[model samples]
Target chain A: MKKTALLIIAVLGILLLRAAEDLPFWGDPQSPASVHLSDYYLEESYEETSVPNIVTSVLADYRGYDTMFETVVIFCAGITVLIVLRRTHRRRAKVISPRPERPGADIILQTAARLLVPMMQLFALYVVAHGHHSPGGGFQGGVILGSSLILLALSYDIQMALHRFKEKLVLLFSAGGVLLYAAIGLACLFLGRNFLAYGAWAALLGISEPEAHSHGMLGVEIGVAITVLCIMFSLYIDLASGGDLDEGL
Target chain B: MEDLLAYIISRYNYWAAIILLLIGLYGMIAKNNLLKKVIGMTIFQAAIILFYVSIGDKRGATIPILAHGHDGAHQAVEAAAYANPLPHVLMLTAIVVGVSTLGVALAILQKIYRVHGTIEEDEILETIDQ
Candidate 1:
């Protein structure tokens, strides 16, 4: 009954938000947002970017400012993960022998890891590259990619996975992604355009505006996806592998 | 009737996405297991991706491939133009944002698990109170 009531409220809330479009209190269709967003982008997008994907053009170029901030937010998250999960040398010394492997852990996980890891990574890369033409993007691709490694850890041993990727390497991968994104922005600044204005650098690269935007967006998205994927695996490692497992064995 | 049904079917993506999102939310808020909560969060985030992807799709539109045509002059007779590729592009960033947030959340959960020796919310709280 409570769940039903909550669902009713949620439905009503959605309806109410939708109804706000019909209200006269809002500005006219000819209002600034409508003029700029719906009309201006509709007409000018093709000319500016030559890309059929208006959302991509807007996100990668027109509103590159917002995307830069989004990248920074992810950078902040990476830092936070390090802060939370970093182990002290002293603590490492104390955690001397590893604990025993949990009963049935080996039998359950070994076969699956041997079979699933490569296939999952392939799917993740596909999602990342085809993002412009399809529904999958850096984030989805990153998670799928990250989860592939996480699955290996879960099915095999957390300690084994940690040794493979290591905390330091994951941290570096996360930092590298943020740096690449910022470096692109700085590159635009050096070219006399605003941050991420790859179109301005077209003269150097000899590419058209649309192609430049596509390349730039791909670069940044790659950075974002890589950072996301590495950080995700790092989190799994932090959660599952901490403390000495062999001591219990 | 057929047209109406077709319209609804085409729009079913949003409904399914919303349902998945709700289920995820329920799992996140109600489940005691930390792993279950993380799984719930993944499902919820996946729903958002589905919603964003569906928004990019237009009825009767083909994939946004640059065909052998210029400004519809030499366009194929059967070509229905292209669906907006922007939403798919935007979703790429959103997917990254979702994973980053999920990573942070999982790290926190891991820390909590470390401190409590158990991942269940009740068990963690009991350990904390003591």
Candidate 2:
């Protein structure tokens, strides 16, 4: 069976290589991907959205619907993991080994986490806020924020992290993030424009249309960050504790 | 022979992506362990993401960000001067989706292990049969 699988994979690889030969060469400025809509996005995104980062403008403005659905997808995954692994009642037979009790939290690790977590969280916020001008963005920033909590969990314990961020709050934040994104679109709809049309927001907020697009993108990016941060930490706790939420690795 | 070598050199990123993809496929297909399969799936995703991001690269271009802050809109921005941002944006979502999928898969794996007391695919199948 393994040999057959290997043979199939080899044939697939060869076929894929052949297909790849027809693709544009690496770093070709005139490649199909570099042309088409890319030129439009590069040249007009700054003017249209007032966001200098073309990727950010294109992601959260031009493709706002796609991003909103992407947030929903993440929310669904978080809820799915919660449903699949979370056990309210304790099982009589524990298939996994019991988490061993430590004597106490290590002073060195706790102190380090205490010093580092605040810095990490501050940097995460900076990344999210400066995403329009820099390489940083919501997803990257959210992951960093989530890892800070994970670091806390690692240094102290699951209970410690849970005490800081409750399980109910995590679920709320996850759902709320998606809600925030959709609510912005609904607000645009209510203001006599199409859904997710930030130009309508300019009238309401008393700003230029492009600035409104910039602010709208910022709002949605914050939503994405909130969902990602909560879901990431939630996944860690659930998996580490094996649904019990008692202790974690 | 020289032309073929030049072609290969210019498109090495695609070749690297293909090799990584094949390794991931092999692991997914041949591994008996569920956890290994999950890791293989991750590797597969990484390869695809790499392929996509590589497509956005331009030889003599800077990043997608405008050089002159907000004033860049006033200037005549050359499209070829900047790398493609579309693929980068698409892959950002893909990376997040990949992480979420891995989390869900591992959660399911935990449930399977709890019920079956083993994570080996063949063993689980045997127990199911019995």
Candidate 3:
């Protein structure tokens, strides 16, 4: 069986090599991917949406629907983990007690995390808010924010993290984020524009069209950040504890 | 022969991506353990992400973020002067999707382990075959 698998991989490798011959060279300026519609997205995105970051403009404005569904997909995965793994009983004793019950492992990690969590969370918010001007957006910020909580779980204890962020609240935030994104689209629609057409709301907000789009993109990104942050922590706690939500590493 | 070497060097990014993919494929197929198969899936997704990001690269270009002006205002952006942003945007979702799938797959594996008492594929199949 292993030999059969090896043979298959070899054949696939050769096929891919053949296909690679037709692909453009490394960093070819005229490569199809660069010269095509991406040029328009890069050139016009800022003027259209007032967001200087091309990636964020393209992601949250041009391809807004795709990103909204992507957020939903991640949310679905988190819910599946919750449904599949969540248990009524604790599976094992806590890995590290919050009060440094174990000597060698706890002291350093706890101290570092104590210093880092606030800084990490502050940076995550900065990343989310600064996406319009720089290289970060809701997804990156959400992951970083989630990691701060995960660090809390790892350093102190799952119980301590859970104490601050209850499981029910996390799940609610995940659902609420997705709902907020949908609400923005619906609100745009009710304002007599196409779904997810941010310019429509400009009249209501008394802002210019481009400024409205920028604000809309920011709102959607905040929704995405909220969903991603909670879901990341939810997945970690559930997976780490074998669905029991207690005594996680 | 020289042209062939240049061609190979130029398009070598795909070669690395394909190699990573094959490694994941072998892990998935040859490894009987469910946990290893899930790990293979993660690697396979990662390789695809690498491939897409490589496609977005441009020679003599800056990062996708636009640079601010000397006078503290937006400059007339040169498209070719920046790496393609589309692929990076798409792959961001791809990466999040990859993490989501891994989380769900591991959760399913946990359930399978709970039911079958072992995570080895052949053993689970043998038990079912009885």
The candidate maximizing TM-score is 2
Q: Clashes in candidate 2: how many? A: 0
Residue A119, candidate 1: alpha-carbon lDDT: 93
DockQ head-to-head 1 vs 2, winner: 2
What is the docking quality class of candidate 2?
A: high
> Which lDDT tens digits does candidate 3 get at residues A150-246?
9999888788999999999999999999989989998999999988999998999899998899999999999999999999999999988777666
Task: Report every candidate's CA lDDT.
Answer: 0.66, 0.91, 0.89
Question: Least accurate stretch of 10 residues (summed lDDT) in model 1 chain B?
Answer: B72-81
Cα lDDT tens digits, model 2, B1-130, are 9999888777899989998998898899999999999999999998999999999999999999987743343787899999999999999999998899999999999889888988999999999999
Please report how far candidate 2 places residue A58 from its true position, in Å: 0.7
Model 1 per-residue lDDT tens digits across residues A9-52: 47854764455334222212332323333345545555566644
lDDT for A92 in candidate 3 is 34
* Candidate with best lDDT: 2
List clash counts for every candidate, in order.
12, 0, 1
